[model samples]
Target: MEEAAIGDAALFHSEQRLQQAARVNDTATIRELIWGKVNINARNSMNRTALHWAAMAGHERAASLLLDHHALVDAEDKFGMTPVLLAASHGNLSTLQTLAKAGATLTARNRLGQTLLHCAAVQGHPSVIRYVVEDLEGIPVDDPDQNGKTPLLLAAESGHSDVLSLLCELGCDLQAVDKESNSALHLATRRGHAELLSFLTSAICSDAQNQDGLAPLHLASQAGHLSCVRTLLDSQCQINALSSRRQSALHVAVERRQPPIVELLLRANINLHLQDQQGHTALDRAVRSQHAALADMIIKAERFHARSLGANGQTGELDLTLRHVGDLSRVRSVLWALATRHQKPGDWKKLALHWDFSAKHIQALENQWTGSDSYKEHGYRMLLIWLHGISSLGKHPIKELYEGLVEIGSTDLAEKVRRQANAEQEPARRCVLM
Candidate 1:
């Protein structure tokens, strides 16, 4: 028993010595150890043999010495990482080539199911990646790891531009997705890989969405990646693509308070009137998030766009129109009459809902009450709410205001308001305030 215990200690010590020799590329000491008939495959506590140590240290001479001694080239460490995998990870081309030429399995994966290409990609080693991809035929080009992330996907996540360019040049699957169906474009955008995003021009980049229905632009906008957003926008991606929540990139930018991206989306003439899953617009979202600058920017952009389209509203001054609509004098007379007759402050909220003012927009408008009476303020807010709907519809606000008055039993005022648009189009005609 004592002799066996001594022998086990000697073996462990010899393995330790072998690791030390390999780390320094001491080929003479390694050859001496091999001549002593030392177990070449002996592993330390981490299950890593001398060749694993040599591969990790990038010692080509020591690695060659071990290989000449018939070292277990494909032996896995505790993590299932073979020497070739380690070599690729460290950018050791010579040692890696030696292992590959020695029949070291290129497809051998660690516990993570990552191949040499996956490691090379993640580490941003283009040379190693090129050899594994170009030199070695039949390499699993799109084989996924445990997370279903392919080599291209991993490269995109880390913003490895050159590696990605090489992969793209080699005709790799540009549309490769991860476990969540997030495409390479999705990851590149999310990580702000502007150059990489610019590299991908396939239709998948413009259309692929993750599990949440968020496209690459949505991720880029949410992450506040200005250049990435520019690349996506330049790629001619669907600027108004909505997510599962029916929210656009504009919504994401506003929610995240990204002003530059918001400006980009706004300049693209995105549908500001589009409602989200939560009944919010980009303007409303900006207000809800308390991003005062973003809110002002959204309002300013919408007003400018509305004017550029020659979409003048009846509200006169464009600023009075709150996000695509405003309260016309006709609706004002109706609400003004109701508040004057009934003198109820809260009652106007119900009428505001009747006009189809979004509860969110209405709630935003209701935040402030002015004048001596809340009823007057409520009436004013109700007028503004109706104007917003009227403005977005680009209809005759004056005509619509007149119709609302007649519907609410205020025909006397309706007849008077009808002449407001006599010089313009018909009552049913969609016209902005002119």
Candidate 2:
């Protein structure tokens, strides 16, 4: 009990000295405390030693003073984060350099499997990264953390072009992939950094493919990065390259509803009809995505090759010699062909069941039905009208619909539908509705 009491008293004094040193930047007082037999590596409630506080506050002098008194360089806080990681995260280059030179192991990983280099790269301190890369020998240039992201991959993903360039110069593997089999170029393209994408495209030409067989161009096209798409196209990348899923760049562009990218790919003579592993063509994907512009472009391209209507007038064949028409009739013919082949019964039912609406096909459908009146005179017209009314019912608001459903004894069904709709709409929130 007497020994325990003495140990407690010493710990109390150590805590006080650490707090005092942090407040006044008092290197002398800190040294005196260490000399007075206070534990040099004593951690407070947060498991932070005097060195951590000093480094966090950019107190290089105090940090140096502590180190001179033999403060533990590798002392970790509650998070297992060392002084070097904290210094790098706080952008204190001098303090980081001090810790490094003092034999703080550069290979130390925190609880998150992040090394000091990952922290420096993520914090965008190119100088710190360069110092770590150059000064710290044996630091793995391609070592990925828990996320399989190397420092170079993190730098590229975060749009740090200068850091990326430095990493490349230091022989960081340009082709290293993360958990998703995504290379640095994939991250660059996914983030829409055209300049970085270009640099990476030129840096690692062969290792750009991910597990999905998606190259940087396919990723850029999928993400609708028009400039990146153009850059990839102009890079002489194999325009006909297919993903592991057998999806071509054109297919992804159509699926993403990026008409500009579609146009650019078409100009490059990319096979517009190239299908994925599921045997669905680019036009099929465009129609599924409900992108009228892309569908029209594909149809026009097909007509330019003399392939008219396919079986059942649903699929169209190319007919190059056919004269292009700008009238409503011509537009109606195209919509009829696309909707018949692509829009299923379930799609029509969804249009009728949900109040969610898109005006994309309204004008073309009205023109087509008015010309022949077959859709109107036939039972299909009544079905279409009923669907339109149902689609417009819940437009007033979900709260209003909820009350209405309760009155009609359909509250349970309404709730179920609302939950399903919310789930479906989550990913689309970031998408441009048009």
Candidate 3:
């Protein structure tokens, strides 16, 4: 048992010395430790082999000595980063080459499912990425990380043009998509990388769809990339390609309220009425987005198209007027519906009184009902006289009316109506016409 304790002590001492040597870039100390029969693969408390420590510290000479001593290249530290991954992340080209030439499998993935290429690409090291892509041919160039993003996708997203070009030249499948059904084109468009987008558009066919059934053009439109949109349109790409949500570029444009993009798409003759997965057209999306101007434009365009069809038109003069009235009626109906649905008696009375007391209709009623003196006495005398007074004075006598009604101290039913009338009078006063 004492001898076993001594062996553990010796192993700990050797690992500590290797760690120190790596930190200080002490090549001689590293070689001497291995030559003196110290376990080259001995791990520290963190489970980091000497190669892991050396690579992490950017100590190429120490790392080479450990590699020469047959230390495990893919030995993971507690964090699961192998020596190759650490070296690649730190852009240690020499250490990476030594580890690779020592038969280190470049495909070793950490807990993140990130291979050495992923690390290098994420670190924006074009040379290290090139080394990994070139030297480690067995590593799948298009193999995705946990996020399902390949090295090419990562490089393009990071705007590492050189690395991106290399990946493309090596046939990295520029159209490979991530977990979001987002392709390299999608990422480039979303990141607003115009140069990378141009390259990908020119180099790769734009028909590649992501998980969303969205081709690159759809993504470009969704991202508001006008230049990318133009390029895709010029390529005769499917301008109205729909996503998994059945949303076309026109739907995305209207939803985003991008007028220029919408105009460009409209010019491209994209189907303006394309519906989404929810059976909502682009006009519906526009209305939902509250882009009133764009919605009006689309509505007018549809109306114009329908009118051009003559008698067989979807909308004739009566249909057009009805549609306009229907829109206004719908708005007013929603206000009334909300009032009734929410049990807002005050709102209901205010709206009802506003519509009832409108000057045009009230004057017409006064003129039409003047023949019956009883109706005239009730409507013309009371209603017209009060309306004339308010119109001339520009204020409803709400306070006077409240005081008069309260002074009478009427029955509970009359008092309730009076209170409701008083509660509704102020808002109605604002709507009163001069």
Candidate 3 TM-score versus the reference: 0.54
Quote the positional error of residue 51 for candidate 2 in Å. Answer: 3.4
* Model 2: ten consecutive residues of lowest lDDT: 319-328
Give one digit per residue, the lDDT tens place, for model 3 in 1-434.
99999988887888799788877788888878877888878787888877887787688788777777788888988878999899998888888887878888777898889888888887777788777766666688788999999988888777777778877777778768789877777777766676776677776777777766777777777778888788778777777677878888888778777887776776566776678879988877776665645554454445344344543643322221123222233223322333233322233223224323333223222332334332322232232223222322334433333333344442332344344543444555432321
For each candidate, what is the lDDT?
A: 0.77, 0.68, 0.65
Model 2 alpha-carbon drift over 4 Å, by segment: 1-50, 65-72, 304-434
lDDT tens per residue, model 2, 1-434: 99999989877977777766954679878877877887778778888888888777778889888898898899998888999888887778999888888989778888878887888787677888878777777778788999899999888888888888888888888778899888888888888888886677676773358877888888888888989888887777888889888999989888878888887777666786687998988877766665655655664454333221323443333322213322324223323432353333334334323432223333222322334433432223223333223222223233343444455555554464345434444465522311
Off by over 4 Å in 3: 1-50, 65-72, 101-103, 112-114, 122-126, 129-137, 140-149, 171-183, 224-227, 256-269, 293-434
C-alpha lDDT of residue 341 in model 3: 36
Cα lDDT of model 1 by residue, 211-283, tens digit = 9899988998999999988888888888889999999999999888788888778767778888998888888
Instruction: Give candidate 1 misplaced runs (Cα > 4 Å).
Output: 1-14, 28-45, 133-138, 309-434
Task: Give candidate 3's error at residue 177 in angstroms.
Answer: 4.8
Which 10 successive residues of model 3 have the least lDDT summed? Answer: 317-326
- Number of the top-ranking candidate, with TM-score as the measure: 1
